[model samples]
Target: MQPSHPGMTPYPGQPFYGWYPPGGYGLDPSDALVTPPGAGLGGWFARCVGAARRGWRPLLPILVLTQALPAAVLSVLVLAVDPSARWDAQLASDSAALPANFWSDLATLLVVVLGGSLLLGVVQAVGWAAGTWVIARQAVGESAGLGAALRYGARRALGLWGWTLLITLIVTFGFCLCFLPGVYAAFALALAGPVYLFERHDPLSRSHRMLRDRLGLLLGRVALVGAAVIGFSLAASVLESLAILPFGTTPLDSPGTAVGAVLTIAVVAVLTLPAYLAQLVGLVVTYAEQRAHEGPVNAAQLAAELG
Candidate 1:
């Protein structure tokens, strides 16, 4: 029995999005940016790995600036808020009862911490969103100008921001509810980005749709990405340790002190830059995949050139 249309075709050389043709000068809007067939869990992970390998170069600087700047700002804010208080039983009990000077210091600390936190949060959001756009552009092998990057981010910033806030609240509230289901919910919601980008919907809407349509795949992929992230983070931690000279005391050795301040700072610099750079590459490829095979970024639709 021959069916009119083959429902289960193999992933061919031409991508479903048709962004690029085989040996073509540029991608055709009409052509499908097809995935290679048999791309299951292993294949998907390989795609992530491959994307990271290819797009590491342009992604490094942007990632470093985006991640490091906000992190540094937050650290400064924390230090400013609580300058040096040893955690003895007595001190812990009487932090508020210490002295007039203590009250004055506390007030100053609150101002710095709160103000810095707010500022850093906004910048971090913008920076991360922009970094995502840059990675997406690179994934598609498209020209990524600052103007275009900003526009891409700006278009989706409000939705992304709302999504971030919503997820943060979910995780925060989850932490209060005995912690297990909250973790699952947080992981389950992680696919909102791919959904957001491809579906071109608000994060909340995307989250809902993904939950309904493909929760299993979404959760599975999130776990995969999380595992990969953790593995790389562990490797970075090891490298950070190695970066210190052979003879050096670790910061953790000292209680309530910046014991390995130098090492900590160095590690943040070394690990953050490269890790994000690689991640950005993976993001680009995934974006392309979703734009093609997945929902909204449809090749057939875009081919009509409505815009």
Candidate 2:
């Protein structure tokens, strides 16, 4: 008989199995079997880190292709449709005779920009859903590859997009009412993705149900994740500015330079996709913990059900 793998844990209701090698067990040992901490914010953070470390292979590519790729494409499009370039050309041209199709050009640019924004939003929502799915699988000690995760995410893409739109509208409305309400609403709805993915329920209603009595803990944890994201993002922005210092000032004025800038930003986005994944993993783990708190549920069981 094969010896028990130190990394494998057969938690209650969940059995641990060793990975097989080529012509062996039919599983890859390199795919770490991670069991998320039972409860608490510390455990949540730890599980997020563990999940990222073990599942980066499956998670990173999905995030880059689904999230960063669309952002990069949109960035390029924005540069191509730059209003400043058109304005500069207009000013440089003969003022008495406006360029033909100037209005049509402007209309086309507007349409492209609007359409690209919508497309990017959809891509991000889908990416988040997929990333969450992967994290959920990893949290419960199950393994999933990029293709499987993407297919799963695509299946629920429409629901994820709808949920994202609903949450955005609600948060926007909350902000209009009051700043605090808006902040509260954002945190309150933060787990909608996990709820939608795992519970297979309407995002808003299920999210509200999850946050019912656990609002305080959930809010605190969400705030911690938000702060980390903001802090890291700010640091990345600073580093990015420094990195582009050698490119000279006003690098985006010319088309060639602007393309370079977009590529640089896209590269940075690709590198940082894991950070976004960590946040999602934390949220997924938290959702499972919350469910466990409500009843006799565990991460492995959730993973099996989600699987």
Q: What are the per-residue Cα lDDT tens digits for candidate 2 across 75-142?
A: 66765665654555666786676666678778878888888977887877777777777776775566
Model 2 misplaced stretches (Cα beyond 4 Å): 1-39, 85-110, 237-259
**Candidate 1 weakest ten by summed lDDT:** 1-10
For all predictions, the C-alpha RMSD in Å is: 7.9, 9.2
Give the Cα-based TM-score of candidate 2 against the true structure.
0.75
lDDT (0-100) at residue 244 of candidate 1?
40
lDDT scores of the candidates, listed in order: 0.50, 0.67
TM-score for each candidate, following the candidate numbering: 0.65, 0.75
The residue pairs that clash in candidate 2, if any, are 20-25
